[model samples]
Target chain A: MIPYLACVLLFLIGLYVVISKRNLIKIVIGFSLIEYAVNLFFALVGFKKGALAPIITQPEQVRMGVARNFVDPVPQALVLTAIVIGLSTTALMLSLAMRLYEKYKTFDISEIRRLKG
Target chain B: MEGRILPLFVAIPLAGAFLVPLLSKLWTRFADLIASITSALLLGVSVYGWLMVNAGGMPLHYWVGGWRIIGIAMWFDALTALIVLIINIVGFCASVYSIRYLDRYTGGRWKFFTLLLLLIAGLNGLAISGDLFNMFVFIEISAIASYALVAFGTEEEEVEAAFKYMVLGEVGGAVLLFGIALIYARASTLNLAHLSQVLAGFGRTPFYWFVIATLLIGFAIKMGMEPFHAWLADAHFSAPAPISAMLSGVFIKVTGVYAMSRLMFNVFGVSRAETPAFFNLLIAFGAVSMVLGGLLAYTQNDYKRLLAYSSISQIGYILVALGIGNFWGIAGALFHILAHALGKGTLFLASGSVERQTGTRNLEQLKGLEKTMPATTWSHILASFSMAGLPPFAGFFSKLFIIIGAIAARMYWLAFLAALFSAVTLGYLTKVVNMAFFVKQNSSVTSTREAPGLMVLAMLVLVVLTVAVGVGFRGVLDHLVGPAARVLLNGLEYARLVLGG
Candidate 1:
């Protein structure tokens, strides 16, 4: 319960940085933080306190109800996929930030206001 | 139902995305050729799939790697067919248009075409995705490609808009994933069919509402709803014309409106009777967006900017119809999706042509385009009429049905508002015509002739489709729109359809 709340807190802090920060690189970092928080939450979702690895090397061990105690592997797999996606996107965002800095000669988002809302 | 062809929807475009760049290294022209051929092939497959589903052999399912529930599932039904068809149609037109239309931009044609294919692949996969996590991944694939494409020009304004768009779109993707995660935790399954069956008994718990709200907010942002639309106008305005057309015409519908409607109605099993507040929230969002988008569009002087706002207004119209949640309402929503895609697509493509020829999109500076750029002007005239809901155009029937649906739902004021916005759409769309096409030339900025033959041909294709759909409104309504709406209207029956498959 505490860990879930902590994950939510991390997500909110990341979102806050995205909303409040003025630096473009910081904004990219903020996005990464949000994604990492979500990935962490996903990984934690499948964790059981005393669970064994989700592998059955012995068929007799599987018959001892060991399968039920095995940690669910789905969320871990999901987290792996999520981390790769997060890495690529964060890299893309950072490259864009580099280009924006070259264009504007500053890292401040407030300076990159050519397109209006 | 035969299911072997289902994977081709993703495979063709995914393969084309890589092939375009590799083939382009040998020759640049091959990029255009490969992209056009790929989109045309996808369009053909979508047509065949539409026919197959329309023949009542629908709700086909394919388990990737034949792993059944453990592997990724691809489900094809009326709704998937409808969206895939729309994506490929606009995609085909956009690809053809881009062949000549891209001359103005400075990028290699290969890069643009590759990203375009990637975007299309993601949308197609999103439409057929039977797993919530896969949908999220496809959403990211499309979002990532679009972010790059939006910045394809690498100009100052384009970069800024792309960054803004990227930030918002990525956040929306995260929010959507969070919702998907919550659902997975609760139902202990990722398959949408399985989730639907399991969640059907959960009722409206606080957690359920929380997840639904998070997902709705995520999609609403993607759809460019009135309140969450800060990124839309800028992104649409900054994107190149073909990208503009794709973004305004199909991207918003596919990523935002279609995804939201499918989830709310099917997986969550929301109904008007059982969840009046859910429906009402949608109605409120629709009402605000229509009024605000129309009023804001009327004030824009930039041609692309106005069309961007008008896209928002038209999206509002579709949302209102869906929110009504009646038979006529659902059908009207589906039809409006088609009508708006064709009409708005031509309008953006025409705007691109005008900008390409004159080197300006400022409505204040350009005039007498009907004399110099007849093809583009006529495309503008026809698509604007359709968008304005004028008679003998495709947009009219959609507006009529939405009004009827609103009336059926006993929402008299909302019905009146829908009618009023039709007129409002006409007023703003006419502003484009009067300023750009009808006004006499004070200067010879209109020196250029028609857009390139292929661009004109692409615009003509969409214009013809709009007119053909309007003329063949009955057949489309009976065949395409009807089944799509029924699938959505039946809500939880989607579970039976897929799980049974």
Candidate 2:
């Protein structure tokens, strides 16, 4: 329960960084942090006490087994997809940051005010 | 055979998108022909689907890997039908417009066509997918394609705008995925129909409310609703003009407004007694976006940027209408979605022509275009009046329905505010028309000839539709918007259709 609360706190911190930080790279990092926290939360949801990975090997053992210990594979699968999406988004954002740096020569979003009202 | 056509709407575009680059190597012009043919086919399929669904009297669901609940499914109903028609029609028009507009961008025509096709496929897939996870995949596909298109120019400003768009959009996606995971964790299902069934019996809890809030915020960002709309103006202004029309006219509507309506009304059962707060929250958000976006547009100098802000404002009106949560409001929202897409798309395409001819998009530099390019000027005038909600124009009736709906819901203040914002919208658009067409033309632009014939023709068709819809407003309201509204107002009927009574 405490760990779950900690995950929520971490997510809030990341959100704060994303909303308050002015540096483009920092904002990206903040986004990554939020994603990591969510991924962790999803994995936690699937965790079971003394649970083993859900894999079937050895027909004899599987026949005798009571199936008391198997982690939820669905959340794991979901997290895997989330991680891939996060990686692609991060890479794309970083490249865009590089381009922005070349154009503005500054990482500060305040200086990127050529568009605001 | 019925289900077969459902998948074609998505599959054709997906196939065309993947084949374009490969075909481009063999024949340089292959991409253009393939894309045009694919969109025209999609338009035909969507119209056919609409007719079949109207006659058949229920949404169509197609199972991807056979008729099992666990396999992927595509559901088509009145709502999806309306959205699919909007997407394919605007998509066809934009693809046609892009044939010439994209010539301005040197090289990478193949890449541009590929991305545009992929975006269309994503939107179509998003509209029809019956499962939550599949919706996420389609949303990403669309988002990634749009990010690339926003930076298509590869200019410094374009890259910067794309960067901002990516950062905000990625955050929204992440938030949405997290919400989806939470919902799945609680309900133990990813199919929207199954999830809603499980959720209905779960009773109200803080956890469910938390998930609802997260989903709403995430989707709201995509919709370009207020407080999360910072990225929209930049992305819309930086993309190529036809792409801008796609983003503002259809993409935001599909991924944002349509998704929100589905989740709130159909999936979450926000009409339940305990969820009145959620409805109020939506109304408040809609009001903010309406007032703020209009005020922001009044201050813009750049032509595309002004249109971008106006897109935000117009979407606000739709949100407000939907937020009212009545038959009339829902109908008005749907009508506004179609009306805004046609009006704004024509204006954006015209902006492209104006930019190409004068080589500038600044309002101060672009004056008396009516004399210079009469056809483009007339299209712009017609679209502008429509946008400002003037009488005898499509925008006017849509806004009227929204206001009347608001009043019927006993939200008199909101109705008055919506009307006031219409006037504010008129103020900004009138300024644009006066400065760009009515004022004296700068010496440099005086010699500029009319836009290309194809561009003029495209704008004329949209103008005609805008006028026709306005003139025949009652008929459209009776047939299209009214039926779509009935689907939402009768949300339980949706569950009956999906779950089979």
Candidate 3:
């Protein structure tokens, strides 16, 4: 329960950084932190006490409390997909940040106001 | 055979996208021809699907690997059918327009078409997929393709805009995924039908409310709902013309609006008791976006930027209508989606032509184009009038239905505000007409000529569609929009349709 609370705290921290940070790179890091927190939450949801990996090797072993031992594999699978998507998004965002740096010679989003009301 | 053809809607585009780069190595024109043919074929299939759904009640669901429940399921209902029509129709026209318009861009026609095809595949897949996680996957596919397309020009501004779009869009995607995860944890299923059944049985809990909140925020950001709409204008402005048409016309609607509506109405079951709060929130957001987008558009010199802001406003009407949550309200929302898709698409393509000829999109720098480019001028006038809700045009019917829906719901003030915003919409569109067509030419635009024949043909087709929908609106309301609206009006009916008796 405490770990779950900590995970929520971490997510809030990342959200704060993303909203408050001015530097483009820092903002990206903030986003990454939030992503990590979500990923952690997903993994935690699938956790079980004294659980083995969800592998079916032997019928005899399965008969011996297998259901009680194996953690849920579905959320882990989902988190894996989420991680790949996050990697792609982060890489694309960082490359764009690099390009923005080249154009404006700065990383502050406020300074990058070629577009505004 | 019915099920077999359904997968082809996605498969053909996916295969074409994969083969594009290889084909481009052989010949430059090969990529264009392949994409054009693929989209054209998809357009025909979507129309067929529309007719099939209209003639036959209920949706068509196809299960991959035979009829196993665990395998992939693609369900096409009236709502999905409506969105599919929008996607394939706009996609076909955009591909035709791109043939000539894209010549201005740099290399790899194959890559461009590949991305376009992938985007189309993603959208069709999202529209049909019955599973929540599958929808997310397809949404990512479309979002990534759009991000690449936005940066296709590789100009400084294009790259910057694409970057900003990626950052915000990625956050929205993450939020969506997180929401999905939470729902999965509670419901222990990802199939939308199954999940909704479980949720209905469990009733609304605090956890359910949390999931709903997260999902709404995530989808709202993607839809460019007010307050979360910062990325829309820049991304639309930076993307190429045909891509702009797709982005503004179909993509946002599929990923954002359609997904939101499906979730809220069908999956979550926003009943009459709960709907008032939902409607109020939607109206508040919609009104703000309507007024804000129009006011912002009036100050824009760049034509595409102005159009982009205008799209934000136009989309707000759909949201407002959906919020009203009545039979006529939903009918108006769906009708408005169709009308806006046609009208805004025409305007974007027309702006492209004017830019291609005049070598600029600045309103102040473009003038007296009616004599110089009669086709573009006429298309602009027709589309702009339709957008402003002029009588005997598609937009007029949609706006009228929405107002009627508001009145039916006894939201007199909301109806009045919608009418007020319609006038504001008229004001901006009239300004566009006077500056681009009626006024004296700026010295810079002396060398401008009419757009290419193919581009003009595309715009004309959209104009014709707009007119057809306007004049033949009763048929549309009876056959297409009514059935679709019924699906939303009775949310419990969706569960029965999907899960069987």
Candidate with top DockQ is 1
- Please provide, for model 3 over B1-501, each residue's C-alpha lDDT reduced to its tens digit, 9 standing for 90 to 100: 465568988998888888888888889898889899999999888888888887777588788877555667778888888899999989989989999998787776778899999999999999988888889888988998999899888777888788778877878887898898788878778777777788888777777778888998888888888898889999999899889999999999999999888888888888656656776788788888888888888788788999999999988899888888888888999999999999999999999998888788888887788888999989989998999899899999999999999999999987998888889888888888888887574434633578889999999999999999999999988988888888877886776777782
Q: What residue pairs are clashing in model 2?
A: none
What TM-score should be assigned to candidate 2? 0.94
TM-score of chain A of 3: 0.87
| iRMS of candidate 1, Å | 0.8
Location of the lowest summed lDDT over 10 successive residues in candidate 3 chain A: A60-69
Model 2 chain B, poorest ten-residue lDDT window? B439-448
lDDT of 3 at B302: 88
Sort by lDDT, best first: what order?
A: 1, 3, 2
Q: What is the per-residue lDDT of model 3 for residues A1-117, given as tens digits with 9 covering 90 to 100?
A: 887788778878888888899999998998898899888988888888888888888887667854546889988888998888888878877887888898899998888877664
TM-score of each: 0.98, 0.94, 0.96
- Show where candidate 2 strays beyond 4 Å: A20-23, A58-69, A106-108, B272-274, B439-447
For candidate 2, write residues B1-501 as lDDT tens digits.
476788897889999998999999999789888989999999999989888888888678888978557778788888888899889878888888788777788889999999999999999999998888888878888998999899999888898889888878878897898798789778877777777778888877998899899998889889889998989999999999989989999999999988878776777777725567877887888888888899999999888998999998888899888888887788999999989999998889889888877888888877777887999889988998998899899999999999889998999999999889889988888787888877564534432688888778778878898999999999877766787787777765566677672
Ranking by TM-score: 1, 3, 2
lDDT of 1 by residue, A52-94 (tens): 8788788887578644677889998998888888887988888
